[model samples]
Target: MTAVVNEQTSYLSDRQCFAILDRASEDLQNGLALRAFLASIALAALRPEEARVLRVRDVELVDDGTGWLMVHPQAQERREKDSDRAGTVRRVPVCRELAAILQEETTRRDLGPDDAIFVLDNGRPLTAQVYRKVWQQARAAALQAHELDSPLGRHVSALRDARIAAWLRNGDQTAGHILAVAECAGMSAPRLAERFANCLRKPTRDEIPWDRLEAALALPEPSQSTSTARRP
Candidate 1:
């Protein structure tokens, strides 16, 4: 939502995230597109690399809004940073919106299990470079001048931060989901915190005790510093 922000280098505001989604959707309807799916997984809290190499078979899009991606950190041919987890697989639940978009993409292309979900204009697999370029274009088109160059969220990976941050917004319950989200994202819980801690929501106006704060602040005049003349 550009209304709240145009973060060029950090996580997106909800409105900006949705705007990108809306733009991606429009682009997808125009023809074969990757940006929409990109937005989908961004909302789903996936790293760019993870989403980049996803296979159709790895994702199951059901008629309902829920879906999940099975991530393999280790596979000689294709892999993620956590691929060395002794061939372990992690499943990350995705919202229905993302599942629906992916379903459409797979169905439209008649993709099989091993087929890469996204491809480049040249029909090669979607690489980070290709996706980055496309994201720049999409962001510029979707955002206004101020947001175009700020840490507000310029890159696609910022979506992961945004999504994770969104989860952390649930307040105390945030801690409970870190391990699960980390597993899904192929990173450890601490790493997840390091990367997306700032995404956590701050206290709202109502949550602040402004009256007490003001009363406390209003109380007293500052005492003057004691004279430090040498007593020699």
Candidate 2:
């Protein structure tokens, strides 16, 4: 029965899933943009484009609530004419613990409504290729940590897969949450579900491993030199 269940579900073990999330979060905390990008996608189930376009203004806390991190879409048309990208404005409620990080990041930068949230140290917007490379590096680190072999590391969408997994595991089984996420990501809900349903399962609080998250926060702050070095 155990084997049957394992074969039938084919889901990543809880520990493995948490490890991936943990590593990604650590990367983000360490000021690794690519890692942070991948981690956000994994935690929020956002599209790569959406993650890349996220600016300080895009995130908000609803009614001063600590549990949600609203993610608004980017105003791409205004930023670049002839750019066919359109963003959907949506609110995402995150773990209350993430509030400080959100606050610090927003205040740390000089971002306008149209500015790209994530950027290179040179002040250039993070291109898809650059983000993709960071994702590759993160995947390699994750695989090496686990001593596992995976060809999926080469795929940029893998981080999205990880996000879907986290979402589903967190109890977003109904289409409501997924739809909300997709709309915020500027994509159709049906399309997201159709392509990524397998990763969507019921969510549980334990799925997030908040204990591990708290520990990561306890680590020392990065030196100003190192921290400021990544800034544009």
Candidate 3:
């Protein structure tokens, strides 16, 4: 059975997420690697452990559109005992933004098929202890003081939660759509629905404050302004 996700899980907004990543890149050593590592979770909805086990060969990057990542089950644990363990893999779509970072990462070291993607400058695997420290520093640099104390962007897993929420919000709430999202996220459809019930609606485009809309809304009365602009 799948683990239950908390319905009230905290998530970072897109702007906040990108800001943190940019800070990580700018402020930390091995910053680009850290940024790519965190971005895989935020953009591709990968679990931290799953992201850890990613190899260069597992990714298929496309410059124009979406790419792909083949995620194995229980990746970190399974890889310990058997590196070649094979079964049905979950294919998560990689957006163009993440593809650029990953491409840079692979090309930086000319990584082989078996080379681990995220590593320290010393070529050591990025350990949880080390990354946790780096994450704290990045958060300190990017987030406001109050947000540092709050649940928002608190843990690395929150990135995955935010990505899943985006998937839920952008897609139809039909059974088929939910199942597809669950497959990519390595969860059951029922579990996904129960956890993210609040995110199943389409975004409101009409609510956006475009320039014309803002101008129309902010138009002064005829007595206040001689120029009459057409309504948007």
Candidate 4:
């Protein structure tokens, strides 16, 4: 799938992202599958199409939290019969939390190598409408009134943006690191940087001098004060 880049894309904070994931996994029907499906995108930055076709054999879970995914390339066109490259795979590391959840799900379901990791309780494949409805319910349950109305966590893709933002803000920003992260997210390094440039910028509030900030709230100097705004 082509990467979608929008300057106005909204992101969820780590807390809010996990809160919604937890609600989806714990409160909704087929919650376990919902959690795994969303976590693949939110935690590992896998595209929805890639995750939809994920098989048990593609996952490599380790006890030391060093698990990784072997993501088969998704077809470029919706009507395409096969992926552009049939056997090529992209690797993505899995977080400890996601690993644990996946472990539990696999064990409980007794899935085979060819079995889809994420499916409905009745063994039916998951559909977009199903997951979207589940996500909306989880978001409503997890967010505050103001947050619900705002753009925060408003779309499923925002979860992937939130993950990439985390890497930019919390991890190394070196060129090599950027390339690695972009590859893992199935995007080009330049596109990733372009799309997430706002994440790389330092917060303006952090650079403001304390005294200057305080002065802005206090009376201005005589020469600097406008006549109409001068204090008594």
Against the reference, the lDDT scores of all candidates come to: 0.66, 0.54, 0.78, 0.79
Q: Which scores better on TM-score, 1 or 4?
A: 4
lDDT of 3 by residue, 90-167 (tens): 899998888888888999978999998988867989888877777778888888887777777778887898889888
1 against 2, candidate with superior lDDT:
1
Global CA lDDT computed for model 3? 0.78
Q: Is candidate 2 or candidate 3 better by TM-score?
A: 3
In model 2, the worst 10-residue window by lDDT is: 1-10
How well is each residue in 105-160 modelled by candidate 1, as lDDT tens digits? Answer: 78877889998887754566666675666667777878878777666666777788
Each prediction's TM-score versus the true structure: 0.69, 0.55, 0.76, 0.76
Q: In model 2, how large is the Cα lDDT of residue 186?
A: 44
Better of 3 and 4 by TM-score: 4
Error of 4 at 109 (Å): 0.5
Best by TM-score: 4
Please estimate how well model 4 matches the true structure, expressed as its whole-model Cα lDDT: 0.79
- Model 2 clashing-pair count: 11
**Deviation in angstroms for 144 in model 3?**
1.7
